[model samples]
Target: MGNIPDHDSYIAAAPEAFRPVLNHLRDLLRGALPDAEEMVAYNMPGFRIRGKVVASYAAFSKQIGLYFLAPAISDHAGEIAETGLTASKTGVTFPPHKPVPDHLVKRLANASIKHVDD
Candidate 1:
């Protein structure tokens, strides 16, 4: 708990207050980007490959923010409306009480990866 050794430790070290959502995001990203390297970038848990950042997840005071290097929410307008995500320029936010739907997360992440690859 002193210093987060890596992504897994960062997620593990998150406060009990934010564990569930953080864990869910961790699981989702790991499943989606199985070969991506996990690192702490800008002090957040980040996933990347070939020097391009794909996605990162963090917990705010009362919400979870999943950020992508490319703009992802625009590609997911329908899902955003359907799943109740409060989107930002490069990411979307979900209430800690409401876990983000798995399909939406994968879609956004795949879009982000494609954006980086392109």
Candidate 2:
């Protein structure tokens, strides 16, 4: 409630069923944004680049959620139609049941980096 849970602590504290998923998501974000710093923002595990909030991940009761702080899919609908990432006003969702697609994540990461620099 006061601050988002820390990612490492979250992974360490999560139930066994979610460990692998959390690990994969953590690795994906780290691999994508190798230089981003970890911070807790918006009550989620947030990543930043040059002080810009780029991405976030949350471990929820139903699924693990990832957010790319870039233009929403609604704004880039045509170009990224087949990516299968869903978006709302705030951010996108990558459901935990399926493996997070590498290409989609990379695209989102690029968008984040671009947006942060722009």
Candidate 3:
């Protein structure tokens, strides 16, 4: 598919049931990375800092997925498990039926930022 132009447009195009989930996750990322630039990367809505991908989210049929562009994102397996979300090799998956926990999202965002800048 072609690019969605911007983050808002990308979120707007998601399934109705998924819009809020996407927005919520986006908000969490924004709250954690205020200085990060919003951008469309890999055809998904994402945040970038100093030219490096920081965080990103994608709306899917069964769940909303959040990716912290850090190799060690899975290092927080304990916290991620508490969110009741599935963890993949790349990121965490938040099922649509359950709201993603704000604290977990923030933690992932902070860790990602530190990994990028530290």
What is the number of backbone collisions in each predicted candidate, taken in the order shown?
A: 0, 0, 0
In model 1, the Cα lDDT at residue 110 comes to 81
RMSD of each candidate relative to the true structure? 2.0, 2.8, 1.6
What is the alpha-carbon RMSD of candidate 2 to the true structure? 2.8
Candidate 3 lDDT, tens digit per residue, 1-118? 3678888998888888988888888888898999999999778989999998888888887788888865547668877776667888668877777866888788888888877855
Candidate 1: stretches off by over 4 Å: 1-4
The segments of candidate 2 whose C-alpha lies over 4 angstroms from its true place after superposition are: 1-5, 72-85
What lDDT does the true structure give each of the candidates? 0.79, 0.70, 0.82
Query: Which of the numbered candidates is closest to the native, going by highest lDDT?
Result: 3
Clashes of 2: 0
lDDT of candidate 1 at residue 88, scale 0 to 100? 79
The weakest ten consecutive residues by lDDT in model 3 span 69-78
| Distance from true location, Cα of 56 in model 3, Å | 0.1
Error of 2 at 4 (Å): 5.6
Deviation (Å) of 9 in candidate 1: 3.0
Which 10 residues in a row give candidate 2 its minimum summed lDDT?
72-81
Compared with the true structure, what per-residue lDDT tens digits does model 2 show for residues 1-118? Answer: 2453688776777666777877877788888889999888766777899998888777767666767765733445554546665666546555566645766666677677777866
Measured on C-alpha atoms, candidate 1 has an lDDT of 0.79
**Angstrom error at residue 55, model 1:** 0.5
TM-score of 3: 0.90
